[model samples]
Target chain A: MTSDAAPAAPTNPGLGALFVGFLTISIQAFGGVLPWARRVIVERRGWLSPAEFTDMLSLCQFLPGPNMINLAVALGVRFRGIPGAIAAFAGLIGVPMVIVLLLVTLYEGIGPSPAVDDTLGAIAAAAAGLMIATTAKIAEPFFRARDWRAILIAAIGFLAVGIFRWPLLWVLFVLAPLGVAAYWRWRR
Target chain B: MGAYGQLIAHFAVLSLLAVGGVPTVIPEMHRHAVDVAGWLSDTEFTNLFAIAQGAPGPNMTIVTLIGWHVTGLGGALVATAAFCVPCCVLTYFVFQLWNRWRDRPWRVAVQAGLSAVTIGIVAAGALVIAIAADTNLARFAITLATAALAWWTRLNPLWALGAAGVIGALGFA
Candidate 1:
């Protein structure tokens, strides 16, 4: 039951490769990073197969913190231990942070203009749309699997967090266990 | 003891609790930064979130904005490091154990369970952001159109965002 089978031989990307790859991903990903990360890692680099990328992404998603950041660490460690991980992490975040700070400073200086506000408003709305589309894509697998229990749990989660506006910590504590138990029992 | 220490401590706790990623902690962050610490106003928080979404890189860049708001460049650096390092360290250690347990039934169960929950959480986040962003009919239309275009086509999302921005600049949306 070795899960290490790569459809193709895995390329051992060095720390520099990891850094540059992630840096490119960071620069190109305007609204969200995931799509660019997928393109660069899975498609361009072929460092991991599609299935491997999905599995890694699922694990990263399951853990805490930002999914992409966790992904950088996990992917980095997979290739070259702590230094590789740091390379990837720094590549993913460092330049972007500088840019964000610079933008913030520029925005502060500009003050509030109705035209700028209108543009930001439009961008925000489009961003929201992008989020909704992302959610649909994420849910597609469950929809394909006909996993009613999983779907139910997700629905309950949405209702609790979105509609009821319950605190996320409470929602996770209550639902995560139940969801896990259901899957556990079903497997048995 | 000092502002940096307080900032580090605050974000370190948030770092661990950021399940489903940084967006999950938006409300808590707002409460602490705005309601309690009095670091930023409600409008500022909303604008920061919006700007982060528009900017390139990870969604968590909002942490940098928050930190910048609190204590300039030093605050931004401290906040981002505190929020990320602990979580990355945890992930680094856990990834080994997880790969070892790759064949475990419980692991499968946990993954399956959590994937569903993740979808739900992401959906909830989308709803929250949509509500926050769509203040008027035109804004709402842009949102719906962008979503529909993204969902139905293979076109890149950037195009939609650009179009929305153009519409806004033209005062159409």
Candidate 2:
């Protein structure tokens, strides 16, 4: 067998495995899926080495749309092409979509009582706090690098979009290319 | 265009521009959903965001919830598909190309710069949601405490969220 020739060859998971893997990750993801994704894809399945998963994740993050969904599509395609991509995407979204819809339906059924409203409001506040934590976590890398230009750019982005309420499209159109150029010049 | 058509158009554009993730595009989502189209109120939007966060799934559940609120199951399906399909197709095609150019300096610089800006944008989005959600001092304090716990501790965020829910149920907030 070719196994002797290439001892390091990674196992190519079947499409079913791809679906099941993403499904498990989706179900376990309460606040976020990236950690669970790392566990399942790297430690549990051994489908991708830790380094490979990191590399893949970096690429996925750089792409548009949700990072987790992009990772799902990328991993699926890498292993089994388009059909695999479909399987993984479907698995990732299928059950969660149903669950969310059901919750919405339930909310609608319960109507808007004062106590229920207060509970949801409190939950919203906590959820917003989670968003704050997320911001700190993502910003940590910039803090470590002491990249002032990037920091400035980020600040400007926040001011323009978050505070001033400028249209996101216009703000990004101006900021993204400038940010790219600044980094390009510095590195060059 | 109809509401379904508008949902597709709006979310589809947001899909490609969601450089970091869904959170990065949330302020704009709030703008369109709350300010422009008048589809949902600020409180309704925040509630949906909280519900999606508390649920066990991807963060994109907010998008699904919004869709369900506006039109129904069909809207949910369409909104989700519109948000996901364009970007996934782009990812599929670009995966091989990205691998080929992985080591290039231009790619490195782009990643570094965009990621920095993405961080700022995400923070802003978080701030927008925070302002909408934290309407009073007690609620704001809960937000601050939850943020601290999430950032400093290894405990699951679900615990903090659950505690806040109980506090609310007790009529404390």
Candidate 3:
């Protein structure tokens, strides 16, 4: 008896899985989603590896938009197909976007109050810490490359803005090309 | 054609300025809405900004708050949608080709450039807020202390916020 060989089918993540993952991440996206997104995909779901997660993050950062939304789309597509990408994008952006609108409702009625300034001052200060944290966290990986060119560029950029008090746009314009040259030099 | 349009334009700029995230541009938004446009006073802007931060989700919520203050719920809609559109569209295209050139040359350069710019903008925002936060020694203490606590604490940042609130109640900035 002769047995016929069959073509293998393409396996894909199910729609239900996409719905659950997207909704879950969206609802929980407080403060930030990067940490949680990494958790759910790498740890909980086992969909992407640690290396893959890091690559996705870098891509999100390199792009010109909300890193969180881009991440959800990229990872979702990897796991659950295009439908999943859409689901994740809508879920992540849609949920928080809506919440912002709703909160705006009550925000206007607070009226004139000095207490707001005090509280916002504190919050703003805390937000600064987060920015500092995010910067260090993102830069930590690049440190392993040990590229002195990058170090000089970063230092120059920092000095221009922090010390000389140059406008941000001007610094970016000058330093962006310098960064490109430095990265090219190091990579080559 | 009106003040509302001007407000939306301001938010659009802020949205684009949201380099790392939304909070980095909070000071700019406050400056524009309260200081430039005169839509709201500093007290009014600060109060709304605080509520927006204390609420939840991304810091972009300030756009909606400013919008609501300037106009109404409709203003809120305009601000939120306008702010999001640029980021969304830009990210979508980025997502489309993300896998192909994840490690391409310009990509690496842009990422490096962004790190420096993000730090600069965030620091700028912080400086602006610090100046505004100045009330007296007590308030200045809250600002410096909160920065230190945040740096040291492994605890969630909300704790720092709550602590600062108590400090604020004591007539600090």
Candidate 4:
């Protein structure tokens, strides 16, 4: 089955458009980048349809490294090959990388101060809350579907890495294959 | 190998293993950078993570900050590139092949399994950071409240973060 709904989708976003599109995403990505990336690529730019966006995102998520970075590369390559990949990657990372480094410099210059420590401490707590919310959102779908195998795998993962303080490499080595096999059998 | 080379090699391995994204590899990074390499204190590690989370951009910024902490600009550049390039290259080559096999039953199983495990790993990361961050009852309460707000509401999390900062400045949390 052909994937495209229509054979002649008129847009092959130029490298410049890819760069500028991702640049906008990077600048506005204060807490998380995915939503912004979706808004820009799927909605604002009309580069990928909603289904295509989800499909691309799932692929990016499945592959290793930072999902968003992989997303930029995949999208870039999908549109315009290796050079496009580089352009999208550079655009997505460039301005924000500089800003983050600058922040680090300023933070270093501040040295160790009580007020700064307090502020950072509180911020860290809130950031953790954000992470918790993120996990809940991701897990919600499986929970809703009563997917016990997935839930069990998740619980094992949490215990192994979160509570036991095990090395992640060993944990993944043991868990990944078993999880995959379990899922495969369950699907049959 | 030189420091940059070592950093690259270490992160390149981490890059591949970073299934689900940077957060999945964070505990490992923390273990190496803080516990193993002794590059930073526990406080510094968590603080830098907070800063990265607060700042604009992708979650990769935390990796960049860690590199910057270790060896200034050059380290940051090297670490970011090393973490990104190998995996991006892998994605570049694999995406087309993967799409062709979209209907494979094994592929679906793999995705489902990996995603569940990834969620679990991310949850573990949240617990690690929460323990590090919630030093007092007030701060702990703030974390719980923020979690609820973020989980249930459509509000942008930046607002919660800002309010938490304000509470900290006022010495309430």
Candidate 5:
């Protein structure tokens, strides 16, 4: 008597799989994709569990790239290896890229009309507001924690460029290391 | 510099520093483009940055605007692709290796610093946008209100932007 047990099939992610994953990030995202991302990739889709997604997010926070983009690459690798990673990266940047190119063409075609100028100006104002709102909302917690150093950094950095008209790279060159050292001390 | 060289240099530098997005590089770009290269004036660059951000898509499109200023459409493509590719390559390898030591203290410091720098850069960008966009009191008021609305309400940014444009055209600003 002989008993045969079939070996388990390996889950090898392919380029196609990675492409699908890339598409997922783009279409799923609307306003932003932080908390919602966790929902889709982990809770809903089961690509990752909450704990695993959290782990990914934490590492991405430190990395010198867009956190979402970082996550997409990491996740792609998880599914399809390095090729998967490439696919995900391309999908994330490349998809939005086509739109960017088209927009530039249209911008040139529109030339400088009254409507165009006014629309652009209004959008600029709204963008300013967007940045301000982002700052206030994001900085609120840092303030509440009584982390005056970051606040000072923000204020000083702002004034350095906004008022003093110093170059940004110069200000960062002077401030970044000092800020890091000071943060190290403050935490201690 | 020749057009190709300038395009390559600009995008390459932008690629290295494009943490949090292109606005993080705005101040530096402004220094290089407006101050150093004499490519565009402060107001012109600011206006372009604002226009790019205010548009319905990715912020990287401003690279095109800069490209157009320096060397026209071809320049724009070169800068955009140059900026996009290298970063994409680096990101793949970095992410693959991150999990091995994700919790180290150095990692913590890096993230804290990145967010802070992003905040600082974005704040500066806003001020620049304000200066260029608010050519008059009404427009300035619109900018102020936009800021308030964005902070208080969760309204879509595009709608507000459209409304503000109408006001501007009507000479309300």
Candidate 6:
């Protein structure tokens, strides 16, 4: 794992290459795109190391919009500037948007069959579990570093958002600065 | 404004407010689409969420579906672009700034702080979806089983999702 202290040298893929890379990632991803993205960018393309991918993902998660969308933009801009970012973003989302629209049309035609409802219900349940697992995976680094303060911050955040149903913006506003300050103090 | 115009304006604000990604805005999306705007019913909102989850690519496609419900193909395009473009531009500029200050102490602090908050936000997102979807005991079991499988094993999530779908189709869950 590469530490945040030192990042790997850039692979500097071209705009066309980024388009193709993201296109493949979008096609290959079924339920979730993040795992496939990691495989393609880190292992297959060598655009980023595992540690660098983790670092980038952390930033992407913090930003607004889809994490993968933010990732595509950041990676694209990193290599080839704004046009590169557009290429990556378009490749990532264009076809998938069409596919999703088609699926929605089909679903509407099918209407409310009990079997379809059941299938969708089970899928939703599983998706919820997948979200939980994703959270655990993202939190693995903190556990490994024994970062108790970070864990406490995460707990507070979960309580505020999940239990209390506080406005997300307010929760982030309150927790983010406090978290930053705490970590900074600990480092000092 | 027209429906298309309303969708663009509404989702554009949602685009920036999506802190931990699209799911974090589910409650707000529900509020707008179901309660405030009267565009979709409660059942429709939940169903759209499920459809987006089951579809390929990003789950944020729910926004596109909502736009489609409001108008048609053009609405889908408008909603998706409005929801994605602003944030993409922001990320592009921020990435340049981040790279320049990669080794700064405050950057490190910000990263650490934000990561923890992100985890919490995601967890909350999961909880919200679980409450909405797990309406029965069998569904709850499926959720728990899948979560355990994902956490304890290296199994592909698609396989778990498929198996659960089969169970549901069979009228078991």
True contacts kept of each: 0.75, 0.74, 0.24, 0.73, 0.34, 0.72
Candidate 6's docking class is medium
Can you write out model 5's per-residue Cα lDDT over A1-188, one digit (the tens) per residue? 01011223324447775566555555433223442344345433556643455446544533444556666777777787777777866665555555555665676677557766666665566556555554554555557777677678767777887777776656766766666666666555
Instruction: Kindly report which residue pairs in candidate 2 clash with one another.
Output: none
Q: List the residue pairs that clash in candidate 3.
A: A118-B173
Q: What lDDT does each candidate get? A: 0.83, 0.80, 0.58, 0.80, 0.61, 0.81
Better of 1 and 4 by lDDT: 1
> Is 2 or 3 the stronger prediction by DockQ?
2
Best by lDDT: 1
Candidate 5 displacement at residue B76 in angstroms: 5.5
| Model 3 agreement with the true structure over A8-114: per-residue lDDT tens digits | 43234466666666666655433345434644554446566544556566555444445665576666666665677777766665566567656555454555467
Docking class of 2: acceptable
Regions of candidate 5 where Cα sits further than 4 Å from its true position: A1-110, B1-10, B17-54, B65-78, B92-99
RMSD of each: 4.3, 6.8, 9.1, 5.7, 9.6, 4.1
lDDT by residue for model 5 (B1-173), tens: 79779778877777767654454676777888888778888877876665555544345656767887787768777877677666666766776566555777765564455445545654665677678767777777776786677556545444666787677677565
Chain A only: list TM-scores of all candidates: 0.77, 0.64, 0.59, 0.66, 0.55, 0.76
Candidate 6 residue spans exceeding 4 A from truth:
A1-51, B1-4, B23-47
TM-scores, all candidates, are 0.85, 0.72, 0.63, 0.74, 0.64, 0.82
What DockQ does each prediction reach against the true complex? 0.55, 0.46, 0.24, 0.49, 0.28, 0.56
- What's the DockQ of model 6? 0.56
Off by over 4 Å in 4: A1-64, A74-88, B1-59, B62-75
Error of 3 at A65 (Å): 5.4
User: What tens-digit string does per-residue lDDT give for candidate 1 at A1-188?
Assistant: 12122336557899999999999989767666875686578656789875567667767866789989999999999999999999999999988898888888888899667898788678878878877876776676678889999899999999999999987767887888888898999999
Model 1 regions more than 4 Å off: A1-14, A28-58, B27-50
Between candidates 1 and 3, the one scoring higher on TM-score is: 1
Give the candidate number with the greatest TM-score.
1
